[model samples]
Target: MSSSNARTQERELTFEEVDAQIQNADLSEFENQDDANAQSLDLAAQLKKVCSVYKVVKPILSLVGNAPFLPSSWKSAVKTFNSVMSTICV
Candidate 1:
């Protein structure tokens, strides 16, 4: 055989070797996707818990903000809370 042909043959993988490599890559992709899904679920659960607390606290803040001998800074803090709740709940 020519030198170039011998080199090419040496570099070529067998079909079974190529298939095994592909299968390994697919398995790794599945593992990565599982990790991604678990992280997504974790974030969703945390948000749900936070929003639950937001439901209880928002109206109390509103009531306190409206009818209190508080300073302007307290009102501003309530506005900040409202803005944050709007961002998160939507």
Candidate 2:
């Protein structure tokens, strides 16, 4: 066999080894996504508190909603913002 073929076989993994590597990668990806989701929820909670304290909904919406070609989701987000702002301050 040629030296290149010998090197290729040496670098190749068995089916089980490749499967294990793929599983590890998938678990790692899931863990990273979970971390990102937790961070997003935490940030949203923090922003909600800040908005409640400062009554920032109108200003926030004005800044973001005025952009051209806003999505339908943004319109729903605006409604949510309005609802959030409507809560009676303690």
C-alpha lDDT score of every prediction, in listed order = 0.58, 0.50
lDDT of each residue in 1-90, candidate 2, tens digit only: 569645633553345544554454423322334546656667667565555443422334534544458887886787566556655322
Runs with alpha carbons beyond 4 Å of true place in candidate 2: 1-53
The TM-score, computed over Cα atoms with residue i paired to residue i, of candidate 1 is 0.48
Error of 1 at 46 (Å): 0.5
Once fitted onto the true fold, the runs of candidate 1 whose alpha carbons sit more than 4 angstroms away are 1-41
Candidate 1: lDDT of 17?
Answer: 48
Pairs in clash, predicted candidate 1: none
Residue 26 accuracy (lDDT) in model 2: 26
